[model samples]
Target: MKRANFIFICADQLRYDALSATGNRVAHTSNIDRIGARGATFHGHLTPNQICSPSRATMATGLYPRHHGLWRNGVALDERLPNLWQALSRAGYVTMGVGKLHFQPLLAAAEREMPESLAYWAKPGSERWRGPYFGFDAVELVMGEANESTRAGHYAAWLRRNHPEVVDLYEPEASPASRAEDLKEVWKSAVPPELHYTSWIADRAVDFIKHQSNRPEPFGLFVSFPDPHHPFAPPRPYCDLFRPERMPRPTIRAGELERMPAYLAEGDDPKKDPYIASGEQPREQGFLLRTDDISAQTLAIAIAHTHGMVQMIDDAVGRLLEALAGTGVLEDTYVLFTSDHGELLGDHGLLRKGPPPYRQLLQVPLVLCGPGIRPGTSLGALTSHIDLFATVASLLGLPAPATDGIDLKPLIEGRATAVRDFLFAEYHPRRDACLYNQSVITKDWRFTRYPNEPAWGELFDLSRDPWEHWNLFSESEFSSQAHRLNSILDQGLPPQPLIPNEVLGAY
Candidate 1:
């Protein structure tokens, strides 16, 4: 148990049905559903490369984007190759990577074009992510988690220049509710409900895990959480803790977009996209933009304010798992919750996970509890997230280093000898609103291959449309399961001419 230390816990676009241990009867996780009752909860996990800095550079370099090519999201990861904190600090652990290390930098020296936002971030500098990328030894950068007063711009200017509210719950539009219609999430029918930014990223991730268990080695913390991702803000009695009259609508069907598949009915002039359009989302007064987050009255009050900000990030993952079982290190640390991708929240009317291979933005949520595994078990066969760098290098016995992923300790220990049986996905659209697509799911077929540029391609038959609401690649009744996941997405990935950003150029 001592050799295990890994505490990962990343969450951004979250949604594996926002957890109630996955049954989600309307999520409110009593401690992120007790981390699936203490470990092992695959639930068919998958997310090879689905946006967000190429899925946080394939989980900090377990490679895939054709082997660390970082397939898109403001480009940037050619950090001279080989990562995962340089193979867990060359096999000794102690990694540390607090909140949103979507890291950016590597290419700089005057605008050769890349700083498109963050007000032209130091010329080629702005690609989202300000520093320490993933070589985290320590990092805390929460200057703002979406404008509109959240953390009152610089945490209320450093709590009016140092702790004045004294927990009186100061308010700044309960800051951190940036959904942009000029930022929102207004609260205060009298104070007591402020301090938001998902409780300032869960009390700075439990005081950086109680300052890294007051040092003694054996650590790898990477606690990230940017809120129910995007300005569908959170903080104000968890913004009306869901009840847009029991929200939950848009399971999309009506005229079933005339039999999907021409790039999912091209939902936004990808030459008339109606591919079961569910593109934009954010309501309760505004947002819903991929040309309107399709009404059912703005998707039931934006899915009850995204299920009350996923029960306030499951009460901030139950206060970072009660500060890791009150420092007894919760059965010897390993805890690896998930989500760098996943959140089309509206499901098909897509809220924001950009256009491509949408299984509500490529099926994410790959829980793996801790030490050895099997606790309230759930593996559903397929899994990836580049196998968390060979399942944390086989839980620290080490050795799968420069990872391209695939060593899920024999499917989180239920044992089945899986070296991956068809599951791949990728889409690079830097933004023409969002469209490029490519997907290949297998243990029963789900191919999506949008080549119309704007982005569209789908094929689901989860044993006959399991709520994928029908989109069978021009049904010849599932042309041999969409030609066997498009010939395994044309012979799986990797081997593209990459590597060469000794700053920014080749890769």
Candidate 2:
């Protein structure tokens, strides 16, 4: 069989229910839906970690955050670690990334106040500058939301050259006086659709495909879109695409947090908690938007903008697909669409994601399309973002890396009913003490436990309460089930060597 080219696209902080295919009436994601229609959609896919850098590290290395040593947002990946792109490249595939490859934490340099290790890509003439980052032979990166001052890399350089007038919009500004008013639910970027980061990612991805279509070797392109995350600002028509009145409000019970673990319950106060601090303070300065007390109208507007961002990404996906078809590689290319993690979206009175093990923050959308894939199929098999490494390696006939994720090709080809019986996810806190939690999800239940605080945890009978309205951890009726799930977590991650035996054999 001939090896197929690969195009992996991911959106930042996109949730499982954001797609129209998921019966989301508010967000019209026709392009993403088309991918699902043409391939298999894994409905039970979950992320390994809930943050940007750690989850992405798992995707790249096929190892959990702990093993990879990037358990937090501000840590950098050990360059010596085995990378999926490096394997593909060694197998004679051209590797390229278009946008937002958060292999390194977003504000690492700024937060640590380092001089040599700048957070963004190095300048063209810098002595330490180099390409083929983290196994990617070429990378174009952009950090933060549309108006983020920290935005840099090829995207920033492109804006300076092509749209100099709007470059100032992305420049860093002073932190706002208070976060009480800025909840990150809704905002409008002065940037138009054509100049937006989503548009830039699509433009570069299409260009790369066009440039490499006639190459002798197969190519692997990672087209990443940084949007729908926060500062909920979508440009122009997209900002107005979803009306606030028509969007669904967050699922909030009167006292949902009352039942939560003590650590999680404390997040109910934005003024006291740092994680939920509204984006009024710059991330470099260590402040997050508080989602605890947002009003119904603000939450609705945020949802509308989030949907609009999804729509913009969907449109960009449409353009990239068109480029593939135009280049005559559409038939032979394999396309995978997913996200790093999910947003809280006002679910359970939370606006952003943190240590919580709620489904809204853990579950993500996974769509696979191309040759050998069953079209219009939905698989409920448990899958994780880490699985992409093994699956892609298998698809390309490359040597598999040491990974905790299993090969999902069987599930994608309809050859298996399920891949794994249970899925595990984790979050490690760096700045805050409360933001540390691990979860185990089985066919009928979701259980979470915190380190050093065994008595304080979460247990939900997902089969009965999918919304996770009740906590069963403290109830005696469900004590046995909780114990069993906790046992599974105690066993720890599946066996995965830090260095694959094959790589060692090369010595």
Candidate 3:
């Protein structure tokens, strides 16, 4: 068996049901679904964290957030950590990372600049800067999420240099009224599809694959798209693809938060909360949006816009597959698609991510297709984002470094039916910060506990309430079940961080 090329495509904030293959009736993801047709889709896959940096760090190092020490969004991932791309590079694979690789803080100050930060990339001669970053031999990065006005990275530079006329089209205030909808944070970008960041990322990856096809060594390409994350702005025709009327209403049960945890009962005002006001996340937008007060129309429009973004990403995925097929490496390359984390999408009357990790925020889509992978299979065996490093290393016949993840090779190849018995996920407000919460998800139950406030917790019977509308934490009838799950959580906890938490910037 020869070493195979790997094209790992990741999307930020893409939920489990975003793909048509994954039971999304509204989103047309034909290209992404093709991978599932050619391989398997892991329906039980869950992200280890709710934020970008921590979850992405888990993918890179195969270590949970607790073990990695990047407890929040703005913290930088330790470069010394043994990462997946570095392992591939060591095994003679040419490694390249394109688009949003949020391994570090994007809003870091100039004094403490990082490759992933806007401050570092905005400097002179930064255009010539590529990786050796977090194991990738080369990188073509795009900083920030959907908003392009403040974006920095190679993609932003390209937009400014070649497509100056369309730069203002990305700004919400400058966008023509007709081009955008009446709803806030939902718009049809006037920027052409070819020049959008989503397309730019695909274009770079396709070009790299075409060039690498002529080379001797197998290549590992990390093509990450920052879209479908937030702002819900899709380019041109994609933005008009979905209608609000056709979109599904959010799964919000009245008084859902009041029954669960006290902290979740009320939305946080960034101006009032000390942690959020001083935290790394941009204060202008507020840490988390309050969806409870928003009208149903707004929620529908948001979902519709989100579906449009998903469509654009699907088209981008189509282009990547075409590149692989055109280069004659389609059979020799493994194409894996996943997300850093998930968006709440108005689930439980919550908008955006943070606090009270629901299934909508924790479950992410995982699809794998390549040599030896079973085609058209959908496996429900529990899996984690941490499993990718070990699985990839096994596929390439390389010795994997010590990691918290287990190899999913047997499961994907149809040799086994299950990988792990349960999954664990966590979130922290800041580096070395308290008010942290952890959840243990078993086959039948999902239990979350906040270590800081031991009395406040969430417990749901996944087998009975898949949407998690009912919180069984304080219910005496389900106390025994909660106790069992709590024990599992205690036993399954990973080793504490050995390194001190380093503060880099506001997230």
Candidate 4:
């Protein structure tokens, strides 16, 4: 069998149900839906970590956060580890990476020499530097999430050099109407949709596909979009695509946090809290709107803005598909679409991600469309971001690297209905702090365990509480159920290292 060309597109902080095909009626994602139309969409797909860098590292190396040594967002992936891109390159494939490649710290100290750092890119000779980053033969990146002040990488340079007039338009406070005093994160950007970074990423990806189609070596292209991550600012036309009134109200059950961990509940001061003061648990600082303080209108605006960003990405995906088809490699290539992790768009009274392994932050979309893959099927078996590396190696006929993930090719080819019984995720935010969280999720249940606080944890019977509104960890009636899941969690935990990995920076 001939080795297949691969095109993997990833979104930053996209929810699983953000696409129209995923039953989101408010969002128009026709282009993304095409991938699902031509192939299979995996359900119960979760990220090993909720944040950007750790989850992306898992995808790149096929190892859990602990194994890969990127236990948090600010840390860098170990270069010595075998990554998917380098493996494909060794197998005679041309590897290309475009857009947000958050494999390194984006906001580290100036002396750290992090390539993804804004300060590094702003330096004099940084313009000429590109290639062999994280094993990609070539790369074009937008370092961090969409923020005007913090913009850097290849995209920022291009915008400044050619389209300087539109730089200020990228600011959240550019337009008066976009400035929502109540919700600082929600904004309608003044920059035109065509000039947006999402469009620029698509442009580069299309060019790469068009250019590579004429070459002999099979290509492995990763086009990662940074939109839909945060600071929900969509450019004009796309920004107005969804109305705030039409957006669904967030699912916030009254007094739901009381059942969960104490950190999740409001009116708890970090300075006063023993766990936080002792540096055992990281502080749960607000990420934009607080769950209890957010008004319905504010939440609606943020959701609508996020919907707009999704719509923009959908249109961009359409362009890439067209490029592939136009280059005559549509049938010869496998196109995989997924997100690094998900966002908490007002789910369970949470505004953004945190230590808790909630469904909203962990469950992301995974669509595999290509030859020999079952089309129009939805596989509900447990899956994780780590699986992609092994799956890709299998598709390319390369020796699968030593990885914690299983070969998902069997599930994709309809050879098996189930591959794994359970999925695992972890989050260790700070080295100094003991906020080590491990979660074991089965088809019927979701359980998160905080080792430091054995008495406080989360156990949700997915069958009954699909929304995860109720935490059944402390309930005596569900003690047996929690115990079984806790055992599974114990098996998933990796052995602690003798020397802890260095924390490069705070994310």
Best by lDDT: 3
Question: Candidate 2: which pairs clash?
Answer: 185-302, 276-289, 276-290, 277-288, 277-289, 277-290, 278-288, 278-289, 278-290
Each model's number of backbone clashes?
Answer: 26, 9, 3, 0
Q: Which has the better lDDT: candidate 3, or candidate 4?
A: 3
| TM agreement with the true structure for every prediction | 0.33, 0.89, 0.94, 0.94
**Model 4 Cα lDDT, one tens digit per residue, 323-367:** 999999999899999998888888887776767788888899998
- lDDT by residue (tens digit), candidate 2, 1-507: 447999999998998998988768777788898888899888898897777877888888888787787766656677889988888888888989877876664444444422123443454543234266777887777655666523456666677667888876443232121122545324566676798889988988999999999888899999989887876777778877888898887787777677887655444333333322223332211123345567777778778878888999999999999999999998899899999988888777776676776888778999989887878989988899879899999877789767988998888877898888898887765444444677889978998887656567899988888878778788888889988988898797532213221110000
Query: For residues 1-507, could you state the per-residue lDDT of candidate 1 as single tens digits?
Result: 346677777777775667777776777676766777776777777786555667777887776665676675435766677776656666666676655654452222235433212323433313333334446555544332344222322333344445555324433333444332322232221223335545666777788777767577777777776656654544467667777667656566654545654434434321121112112321111112342424454455556766777777777778888898897777777777888777765555545555455566567776767776878776677777877877777767776654656777876676674566677776655333234556778766677675543234567777766557677667576677677667777687422323332323211
Number of clashing residue pairs, candidate 1: 26
What stretches of model 4 exceed 4 Å from their correct place?
148-150, 176-178, 266-289, 431-434, 494-499
lDDT of 3 by residue, 1-507 (tens): 458999899998899988888898887799999998999899999988888888999999899888887877768888898989999999899999999888887667777768777788768988788878888899998887665433678888888789887778787665444432333566567777788888888889989999998689999999998878877777768767888888888787777777887656556442232123234455421145667566676677678878888888889899999988998999999999999888888888777777668898889999999988878988999999899999989987888898999999888877899877788887766432334778899888899888877788889888989879988898899888888888888788732423377767766
| Model 1's TM-score against the true structure | 0.33
Candidate 3, lDDT over the whole model = 0.80
Instruction: Report the Cα lDDT for residue 43, model 4.
Output: 75
lDDT of each: 0.59, 0.74, 0.80, 0.79
